[model samples]
Target: MNASPKPPALTTSRAAAVWSLIGLVLLTLNLRAAITGISPVLGELRDAFGLSGVGVSVLTTLPVLSLGLFASLAPVLARRLGTEVAIAGALVLITAGILLRVVPYAPALYAGTVLAGAGIAMGNVLTPAVIKRAFPRRVGSLTGVAMMLMAVSGAVAAGLAVPLDHAGGWRLALAVWAVPSLVAALVWGPLAIRGRRAAAEPTSRPDARGGTGRADGSLLRSPLAWCVTAFMGLASLMFYVLMSWLPEIMRDAGHAPATAGMMVSIMMFVGIPLGYLVPVLAARLRDQRVVVAGIGAVMAVGLGGLLVAPSAGWVWAVTLGIGIGSAFPLAYTLLSLRSPGPSVAARLSGMAQTGGYLLAGFGPLAAGVLHSATGGWDVSLGLLLALLVPEIAFGLLAARPTYIRLGPAPLVEAKEIVVPEPARAR
Candidate 1:
């Protein structure tokens, strides 16, 4: 009797997709854990390390700086190593960095921070690309899930930092995060090997399924690219600035350290739902200008509240959380939506993150410095408000339904978009 054979390829693919989704979510969960834990215990670390104002600024700036500096290398890595392998490599960096930071050496702290942040840089740039490639039809929903998970991770890290520190000093609190990164890296190991095999196979196409084959596009030359970069940069600048200094602002306003840290957690908690919904909403829209304008307005109100009345800090935190939560996800969604293919998506993600995070690095550093000088948060908060004008303007420009002009190709659009005269040449 002949037995019917199960379709091995189909079964294997289904299994792989399930694993991909799991690995992707796990990776997103760890992205913010390493960084967000710091703000809760910033004062303790400062006192322990004898950090001066400049040292504090540098410490605060390290994450954003590493993200910016390492972002450009993402697409390059994708080009050299397979995307899966590159991401695997990123997780390795994150795990090692997390472990490194908790060592008794002083230099290990900054060095580890930079290393972890760099790994985050890679994750930030490629995560959207992976979604665009693996779940093309489900981009909106999957992105929502990923963003939601990322917010959840950040909130958890912030909320638990104090508790963890109380249980076992600051070192143990930071060291605990290494567990997630290590687990994620292990999960990625087989995926990376499988990816490499798929890339080498003659019948396999990397571009079709998260491989990093080159796509035809001169992304850097496009002005729309700059608009996307500017909007993302400014949005990130606002978010990181608040994340880095919001705790200090609250602490100085007479809130307890735990309470102040919880504000950061609250901000992230509010982000959880917004992170899920914003991408879903933005993805359904052909023109995102209204969404962009609305986010800016919300952020403005929050900042205004913070500046005028630090007494009601929780109110501002929730408000800021909604705006900040929506803004970054929107920026991330544009990276995938604006591109026609995975290759272009990865490239655009790299470009946006490199320029954007570099611009954002200045935010935390400047915020730290400004607070140090003025000895108050009003000036720093006000500057963030002023920056919103340009943020919204660029957001409007970027939200146009036009796809980035690729190489010498004429501008493409998801819908009919009239190319402005100034953008025609580029």
Candidate 2:
């Protein structure tokens, strides 16, 4: 009897690489659809569910809170399960959650939201690490591509939600989004299996960033890391607030329901091209402080415009879109740029996203509470304006050309094995 040959080592072929990129794009597309899709049909859902203002706010807040709470688990899962496998699991969770949300029960809806959000949070933290490992040389371009797709998908979901709800009611509208997650999972599963096989094979190459153990602990003490966290958190707070309430703002200003939804879409659509462009540019720059300040200025101007004259909603939408689109990718880009290597990138991403989303989760709830208390949008808008100060300040600090030093420097001896001679010289 002859011995059987071992299977060939796993390698990424050109076709396979293309498929992986496509899978990533598809995955990015699903990240926000489940969250943003609900906003357009929120009014209908409120009526159908008999929800009060706070209940409506919670509908948006719970998923975002889940994103933050679950993000820290990604690196742990990836270490235990392999990155690709973890991502596949996330997709499954997303699909299941999306399906569960349409079950016509409040508990089911919230549970589904939490499930889907947890899944998305895993993908959010790991995507940068995957890109860092797979496309080190083209991080900017690939990050741009992923961010652009994210914006495009979010825009489409927001724009189409009301119409889809009209066509088949809110349940169908929300449930139909699960199809994309299912498709992405089908596309990604084989890739994950291949990755698992490759990882199982032994290699002599040093782990990226030297070692992954306890190195991330240093980030807790690094001022730069805190700055990055603040910037990410505040930006997210602003974006999610707009996403949750922009349609309502438009409608309150006298637009029809469909038009109001489209206005939100317009804001998101304007960000798509800028999302692709901003990261590429930010990556090439020496220091991103100027760009950060510029984006902040744009957001401030747009928010002021909306507060004063929302009837010209398109103008404000375009401005706000460009500001957010540029700011978001730039923030994500900094996660990779400021880190020394992929492991550090993963840690930074996890920290930024965990803290960021946790803070962001409060934005919608606070806005709802303020509006309820004041019976107007003025106080809510004012709060957003106040947040911009910290965002811009921290963004500038985080944008500086510096890396988070993970551990203390090695000790150096001025004189070795010459104590007597050194004392004589002294």
Candidate 3:
């Protein structure tokens, strides 16, 4: 019997690659616009709709919880439709969900979020694989750049939504975001067409083995895989907590609502450039442990400032922003860096995010509950501080220059694996 033929290479001209990067940035920009945009408007919506704190928290929680389930279904959807088509369809669902808020009914509001979140979930899980497949040599750079776009869009939407809502209604503010989504869809529409054309060609069939395996039992057995999963999970938990509670945290410190919202936006703003910068730097480093520790230190300092010196809050927010911003993209970059191939990247991304965001979903809820219990943000921030310890430890493990070594190959002789001591210290 003949050995199986090697897969065809992903072919895109340098110009096409550049264009795809641009498209990726735009697509990423839309992913969180609807979600982060809503965070600023939550108070307005809650009052208008007669929602309780728990009710609003439920609204916030549902999308992230749904993301894991939606992500599980994404591979199937990608198989049924081409990947680009699935991504495009997700954008349409997001647009429809945003539009649904025009009615402002409780059911409609919640329903729209679910639909919109589904779109975000697919984009979140798939974009890394797409980036890796399309820009193999520049995974770190592209992941950083794309995540930067996400941070920028999120900050813009969070900061601007209130002003937009005041000028136009919340309905208009919510729906106006549909323009960017539509624009991204339009930009990506051509790429999808190009991909479909390419995919339909006989030459393209060689690349179509669904390269990675399913996120099945064997994946759970891998220790390195668990490290990646934990790193992704803890990082996401930190992110969602800030996104969900930062503005309120600022408000409690006595800032005006608008100012607090802007402060929250500012924290995310510092992350935008770092999102692009950190990954490029990290990729060149021998080990990412130093970077991980440095970022964690920055985060600790920023959080400590918030707890100790409420007067210098703005400065601390900027510091926190840099720390969190860099950390977020780094976490995303790890998904690709740790995977053996595009197939594995896809599978691991789905698994990591499924477990990761489920862990993340609890962060803000726990923060809110802790605040209610203790009557302050101190306990909440303290708890987050404790969580960061493990994140730093696992991030160091993940940051090391090695992919997840699978179980012994069938025909190859067994050899002792070189387990790094630093990773074990974590």
lDDT agreement with native, every candidate: 0.84, 0.81, 0.77
Ranking by TM-score: 1, 2, 3
Compared to the true structure, candidate 2 yields what TM-score?
A: 0.84
Write model 1 residue lDDT over 1-426, tens digit each, in one string. Answer: 999778898899899999899889989998998988887788778877877887776777788789889998998898779789999999999988988987777688889999999999999899988887787766777788888988888878977999999999998888899898889999988889998887787883544323343466677688887888899999899888887789999999889999998898788778889888888887767799999999988998999999888879999999999999899999998888777667677888999999999998888878878888998988888899999999999999888887765768635656632222223365
Estimate the TM-score of every prediction: 0.87, 0.84, 0.83
Which portions of model 3 miss their true places by more than 4 Å? Answer: 1-19, 47-53, 193-217, 247-262, 405-426
Q: What is the C-alpha RMSD of each candidate to the true structure, in Å?
A: 5.8, 9.2, 6.9
**lDDT leaderboard ranking:** 1, 2, 3
User: Pick by lDDT: which candidate is best?
Assistant: 1
In candidate 2, the residue pairs with backbone N, CA or C atoms under 3 Å apart (3 or more residues apart, or in different chains) clash, namely none
- How many collisions per candidate? 2, 0, 1
Q: Is candidate 1 or candidate 3 better by TM-score?
A: 1
Using TM-score as the measure, the top candidate is 1
lDDT of 2 at 419: 15
